[model samples]
Target chain A: MTDRPALSRVRVVLVQASHPGNIGAAARAMKTMGLSSLWLVQPKSFPDAEASARASGATDVLEAAQVVSTLTEALQGVTLAAALTSRRRELSLPAQWSREAAQTLASRAEHGEEVALVFGNETYGLSNEDLRVCQLPVMIPANPAYSSLNLGAAVQVMSYEISMALATPAALPVYGEPLATVDEVEALMAHIERATTATGFFNPANPKRLMPRLRRMFGRIALERDEVNILRGMLNFFERPLPGSAASTIAAPTRDDGKA
Target chain B: MTDRPALSRVRVVLVQASHPGNIGAAARAMKTMGLSSLWLVQPKSFPDAEASARASGATDVLEAAQVVSTLTEALQGVTLAAALTSRRRELSLPAQWSREAAQTLASRAEHGEEVALVFGNETYGLSNEDLRVCQLPVMIPANPAYSSLNLGAAVQVMSYEISMALATPAALPVYGEPLATVDEVEALMAHIERATTATGFFNPANPKRLMPRLRRMFGRIALERDEVNILRGMLNFFERPLPGSAASTIAAPTRDDGKA
Candidate 1:
């Protein structure tokens, strides 16, 4: 009713679904829980008669689905990709449980991030090829004896977890308000790089060696926006053209100058 | 490692919850969605043998459950209340949809308003007394032919709706700002109320009528503390005598000149 929970950034895609019916069911499941942008990666029976019928109330989602040849193409512009899987692939990293994955996505989404949670084909789940493309693997826990989860069921649980994680919490603020933006943090890092270069903290002779250490330190802080600004402001003090003295002998380029 | 989403301001109260196991499962669902506060109005078998096992890892919510005597007592100070029912109610007024009720509760919750979502005993959705107390009723659309939802399932869906309604579309401010606090907002609201009361917008004689309208308007907006302070500053434009001072002044002259 309210634009499916304002899902402007979060995208959910099911790849290579074997049963068109499952795809339809997945769409309906997603629709019910405030998710709708479904992507199909060469679905075997998608865009078919059965899928539309099974989708029941979510025919729009089925008809509007994008059919892509490869998983990479499906994941274009997706900064974080969580591949939904039933079992840990032989070659894959440790699978994140639903709660863990949802929290991860929520934390990132909290920062105004665009994320895609990818679900694989019905029978095989995520293939090794698909696993290679995903940033993290998400495994929904089910009865071990009957570990085979249907595509719609998997989607339901994952969608439920995501919705739960994104629920507006009632108590104290969880994420700091105005948490640092990606650009702000990057700008702070750039300033840190510049200041380090000026102070010979990172030897221009060996910039790589000096830079990584500084990167590690910044990583440790997980700097929020206010913290980033504080650091950048301190750097800016040095970055400022030191008061009237020691003007550059060379002609200085002005604002909007055609300098590279 | 991360904080779960905060619970909604709409507290979930189970009235005379019959089964300990069902109660435990309900607690688990609430906890999973970051809904920590649980109120049991005269629970029959809470803290029973099967509860802990059924809770399946959300013991904290169960441990913290607040048990009160009557439904009214449980709903004390609640600005709004909603009862979840599957069966048709014998209300004089027409029924409200779940979505409408959810939005109403959600908006109130946004403003830190105290609200309670009442769920009745497992056998019955809600009692006649429970229905009488609730300001709104929520009906979950299900298969009419076979619409028997388990208590936990009902809670999960209701919580899901509440959570999703609060889901946001705004981009969080990135690194470079201080987070707002509740105290600062309280101060701002106090200032505005005083000024508005003097401005006659909040009339003393017809307060109940005007106040709810004003409250609804306020409830619709997500007011950060900084914004609240700005609003207070705007309200301070009126030269309003302090209510405490005015009351004391009005009382003092009469005391000095009285028969005593």
Candidate 2:
């Protein structure tokens, strides 16, 4: 406990931030709220004197920040990416309110997942292109009349939400046993698709557009580690073994041939 | 709820110790752990040169500490007092393991009963006379082999225990409405005693013996504010209603009626 920390397993990425000073201020806010992993994506100006000066005692965050060229580069191995969006996007990604986003992101972080909360430029929020790139646009609710929150305030709100969640461990239900990890989730979807291609969940001729909807529901639950294992265990039971089909396997079922 | 502290209330009392510095540290612990209204009975020194310095940023607590000449004086007006003992005590009224004692005292504190937790002197714990004054001798379980904790640490443990009991009352019963406050408890006790004395459940001439035992039983449940009001209402129905019969009155009851 003495080690306390700069919060681990999560990173804050600000994209195309116009001011170096805002970067410093953002760093200060993150440190105050016990978050240190910061990522700068294609900042207009960083490593500037003004930005570092405003950072105050949060020089550690600035020194450790990873400046990347693109948002995709900022993400790579990230399991969950939440884009900060000011306006409504046309794409049908799930729009999570603040508390929902923070809790979901934090739960992922707890189980050693790389969760990236990506912020857009100061002048304009995540571009529609960036929003499309994100898994979800995590919205910050404000007075609709004037809902522009300063960059630092946004970081603080997210930090506060996550901190509260961590402090109260038993807030959420234990949800069966373990939640499915990204890999397990992918495997489960692949198995489901392979098994029922004739009756596709995502039909191509007149695509039903059902898989994305399923993803949204599962994502909302903020699945935990054990819960994932339980789910995968259940899914694996229904999954075709090895060759994916009983007939295709060495120990293939003769029932289909016998019926024919 | 905001204006007045709950009826079953917590009265945190610090004890005499070699160093005056720990008094402030104890106060800080009490404040953060959500226990306030400190009582200091015969500290080695008060308003000491080093106490405030060691208190860190918690000066308000040190400023509010009540310096009493004796433990009895501190216990006076206190209906339920728990003498926090690190080990065991010579004169024990009822044995209170930390959780038990904390719930009992915190319930009384909230109900507006004069509840108190008395810590001991630094080097030597509470005196036999001091222990005798407490209705319950609360022993905080630490590492039995290496259970030597500083006065501040003792206070912190007691405070944390009280907080746990108050924060979530799972130990009491399934989802209670809420715990009563000190005022509510006092009112209920007064009303019950009034009706009991009239109906001869308690002998008006000498109410002492039955009253203490009744208080003991009531202190155990950790009743919520509403529960206290309910009990008080029942008592009020049995007894004659007076200006103070509501039990919502904030004033401490006079006339001990301890002779019974």
Candidate 3:
């Protein structure tokens, strides 16, 4: 697979990061996703021992990170910028799910356009002014009840999406067999209905929505072609009596005539 | 949307945790993802000060965490267990990507089956015996060169995926206007081409690759119906002379004949 040079063109910018430990953790998260560019805008504390200690082995990213006075300075030379936020603000930039935003940024970066993903302070998040500078707002669709994603955690999620978008697409694991088509599924259902009717299990004259309920149950399973065939074959066997069986000697039960 | 009761049935298990701080961080990660159940197996330390300090306001989860002596005790009532690992092991259970595994777990949980997501020690992942007991192995696809995802980070990613899988799908933020259909976009492109040709900016007789490139650029934007109309209106204005312009006398430049 070709290396995604786009990952290098993308910058991860943190604005007014108050915790040095979070900065270190974010750096580690970026490195794990094969990203190296880091920009700090008006951080409260930098060149701190705690940041380096928390970085694990990603000190190289911290050492080479660019520190700027303002978010605008951090976004210098960036063609596109996306602001990450958890809160929904009125009149903010158009918001996209993190995955969609990652794809857009990767596409632009692949075409040699510089892209920046801006993060906000741990507690307050991005201000309206900070959000206005960004063309898009990206949100991680976390649980609504408890959506307090730590700064490093949020960065990790974003980086993970960006890496997955840029990396070669992996083929989804194929289970047992291909799923049956609509026609095949319908055929199986019809066969089962016919078997049930012949066996007096279901009366066609007074069917009380049993067939539709069965259809829904089968629909949920999404059976494969082979499974459908096996089920139909079972139904066919049930439609007939086994050789030398007592059931074959017995007459079929008549349907209830309206009399209680 | 129906609420996903499965989230409540899922438990997060950390085995042989060496650092008390990681335990706290993991609890915070779980809470952020809306998971409450936490089980610890053979942890080196419990009720430690470091753990409480790092839990960041998720002390409730830590306090409610179940500390057990063995992995079996931790998985007491789990109907489905997924072991999180970074390495591929032979003779292991079916391995799935983290997201896929989360979906499976969530589906099972929704059906009232208890589910457990197990994580191993920080230094060494799950042992072979431990993995054998689990029904599935889940791997997070990080950068191949540096796949050292911290334990808390790994927990956060898994929790995020699981929470997303179980939560009701949130509506994507709608921007200005609905996107144009393929035919509408094509018609708009044709109009622009005609206008550019008439303005002497492009020649139909010797049409170069400008039209195709322009189409690709517009395709990248995925313009809305309103955007298409605005572009065509601008093109129409460009085709004719300005209100007071002198004969629209801007001469078309000759094509570069490779003589430069």
Best candidate, DockQ: 3
| TM-score of every candidate's chain A | 0.61, 0.66, 0.64
> For model 1, how does the per-residue alpha-carbon lDDT over B1-260 read when each residue is reduced to its tens digit?
11223344668899988878668767766655556678898889778767776566677778988888887777766756677877664321224455556666766666556667788886776876566555566665533333444456556556655655565312322322222333343355456556445434445666543333232223323233344543454344233222233333455677788956
At residue B212, candidate 2 shows an lDDT of: 63
RMSD of 2: 27.9
Q: Pick the candidate with the highest TM-score.
A: 3
Model 3 interface Cα RMSD in Å: 28.8
Model 2 CAPRI rating: incorrect
Q: Name the top lDDT candidate.
A: 3
Candidate 2 residues B1-260, lDDT tens each? 11235422576776676677577667655655555577787777889877886565566768877788888877778898887776664435658677678788767767777888888886688888778777888775433323444566566556655665555322211242466778777877777666555544456687655556456545744555644554444344333322232221222233334433
Which 10-residue window of candidate 2 chain B scores lowest in summed lDDT? B242-251
Model 1's TM-score against the true structure: 0.39
Per-residue C-alpha lDDT of model 1 across residues A1-260, encoded as one tens digit per residue: 23323344567778878878678767766665566678888888767887886566678767777889898988887788998876666778777886689888867866777788898775567778888988989865433323444456556556656755665532311332355776877777677666555544434677654445445435644545655654454455443332322221112444326565
Off by over 4 Å in 1: A1-260, B1-8, B92-94, B169-260
- What does the lDDT read for residue B67 in candidate 1? 89
C-alpha lDDT values of all predictions: 0.61, 0.61, 0.76
TM-score against native, each model: 0.39, 0.38, 0.66
| Cα displacement (Å) at residue A70, model 3 | 1.2
Docking class of 3: incorrect
Using Cα atoms, each model's DockQ against the true complex is: 0.02, 0.01, 0.10
